[model samples]
Target: MPELLYWLDLFGVVVFAFSGALMAGRYQLDPFGVVVLSAVTAIGGGTIRDVILDTQVFWIKNPLYLYVILLTAILTIVLIRCPKRIPKRFLLIADAFGLALFAVLGTQKAMALGAPISVSIVMGTLTGVAGGMIRDVICNVIPLILRQEIYATAAILGGGLYVFFNYLGWSENFSIIFAILGALKLRLAAIYWQVSLPAFQIIEKNDV
Candidate 1:
């Protein structure tokens, strides 16, 4: 189970790092900046999760995470020579995949660490979205969750489902698969239908 989760984490990191590099390149950032953004976007959430959970930082313990992020950024720089807007579309898809993968991985990690179901769901949401949130802050834009993306909501729902299935005595493999699929479908549906959460608003004193 541990080994399988490790491999899955790698897959999620590569997708996220690629998407981050693509976003940084679109901003016309310098090569160093591109690498920085990619690293932050790929592992920042995991770092936060580890710190909050009092676990050794995952990427620090596994240098492969850093290696993958750097490799992705370098490859992106080499392949993207046209300097057009192509990265934007690719990044959207990659982001969806990253969100799904991270949500599942995070929930599993929390469960392994003996967190309660609710805490695990929060961890999942953070792990799924924090990287992108940091990426957006670095890029000087509002985070996707703060917008109408329904991004964190999808992660939370996926994590909740994983816990629910596990409580019902399902296999870990099946539970993880279900969680990933749930997150992926929810995110894609939101994107396809342009579904979004309503923005928070406050009534004016005079109106009230």
Candidate 2:
């Protein structure tokens, strides 16, 4: 289980780093800026989760996380000769994958630490969306979590399903796989179909 979590964490880090680099490219940030954004977006949520859980931050304990982010950023720079222009859809897909992997891994970690199911669900959702939130804020855009899109909703649903499956005595591997796939499916659907939750609207006194 630990080995599976480790590899999944690495996968999430790489995908998240790629999304961050793509964002930096969109902003035409310098190489240093790109690296910083990539690192933050790759580990920001995990850092927060660890701090809140009173555990060692994952990247702080594992230098491989940093190395992965750096390499990912460098590769992005090399591949995208023109930083200012890239397909937005590619970034969205990558972000969805990262979100799915991180959500499952975070829930598993929280559960392993004996956190309550509710707390684990929140942690999972946070892990999935917090990094992207930070990245969007830094890039001067509205964070997806705050938008109408099915972003954090997917994470929360996936986390709930994971907990439910575990409670039903399912195997850890099966629960994890189902959770990740479920989250990814929902997120990708939202992305491709522009599915979104309804927004709140305030009516002015004059209109009323």
Candidate 3:
């Protein structure tokens, strides 16, 4: 189970790093920018979670993560010479996959650290979205988490499902897979339909 999870984590990192590099490409950023963005998008959330938990950052503790991110970013740069031709769907699909995996993986890690269930869920959501948030902010784009979108909602739902499944004595792999699918399906549905949560509004006191 542990070994399986490790592989999944590495794959997730590659997917995420590719997505970030693609975004950098969209902005016509140079090679260094691509690598920097890729690294942050691949490991930012996990780094934040580990720091908050008072643990060594995952990639720092194991250089394998760095190697994968670098390799993925380099490959993206090579293969995507004209990034403008890259379809928007590609990034969205990559993000959905990364979100689902990181959300559940982060929850599991928090649980391993003996965090409370509530905190674990929050951490999971953070792991899924925080990197994207930073990436968007740095690129001068609005972060998806701040939008009235179903993005973080999907992450929360995945984290919640994983916790629930574990509590029911489900096998770890089954629980993780089910939770990832739940989040991925919802995110894809939202993207297909352009679904978003209703935004909150307030009436102006000075208005008629």
Candidate 4:
């Protein structure tokens, strides 16, 4: 289980790093900016999570994740010089995959720390969105989770499903896989359908 989580964590880092690099390229950022943004987008959430949980940061304990992010960013710069040519949906898909992986991984780690179920879910959602939020803010864009999209909801649902599956005595792999797919599918469906969450509207009474 530890080994499985380690590989998934690295994979998540790669996906997010690549996504960040692409974003930088779309904005015509320099190579250094690409690396900077990629690193933040790859590590921001985990950093916050570790600090909040009072644990050693994952990349600090094992610098291999940092190396992975650097390599992924370099590769994206080399192989995809023209990120503008790539469809926006490609980036969204990559973000969805990264979000799904992190959601489950975060919940698992929080649970391992003996966090309560609700706290675990909240941490999982934060793990999924915090990095993206930072990246978007750096680029002066509205964060997806802050928008009326189904971004955070996807992470919450994914984390909740993992918890539920575990309570069902399901296999470890089954729970993780199910949670990742559930989140990814929901996010992709929302993107493809241009679905927006329903907003509440209430009448305001004028006290004139």
Each candidate's number of clashing pairs is: 0, 0, 0, 0
**Which residue runs of candidate 1 sit more than 4 Å off their true CA positions?**
197-200, 205-208
- Misplaced by over 4 Å in model 2 are 82-85, 204-208
Q: State in Å the error of residue 23, model 3.
A: 0.9
lDDT: worst 10-residue window of model 2: 79-88
Candidate number that wins on lDDT, 2 or 4: 2
* Pairs in clash, predicted candidate 4: none
In Å, residue 204's CA in model 2 sits off its true spot by: 5.1
lDDT of 4 by residue, 1-208 (tens): 7778888889999999988998898788888899999999999988898899999999999999988998999899888865537787777878888898998889988998999999999899899888888999999988887766689889998899999999999988889989989998998888888787897668998996
Candidate ranking (TM-score, best to worst):
3, 4, 2, 1
Comparing 1 and 3 on lDDT, the stronger one: 3
- Stronger candidate by TM-score (1 vs 3): 3
| Candidate 1 lDDT, 44-111, residue by residue in tens | 88889989999999987878789888988998888876665473457777888888899888988988
lDDT tens string, model 3, 1-208?
Answer: 8998999899889989998998898788888889999999999989999999898999889999998998999999898876548777888788888998999999999998999999999999999998888888898888767666579989999999999999999999999999999998988888888788787798778757
lDDT of 3: 0.90
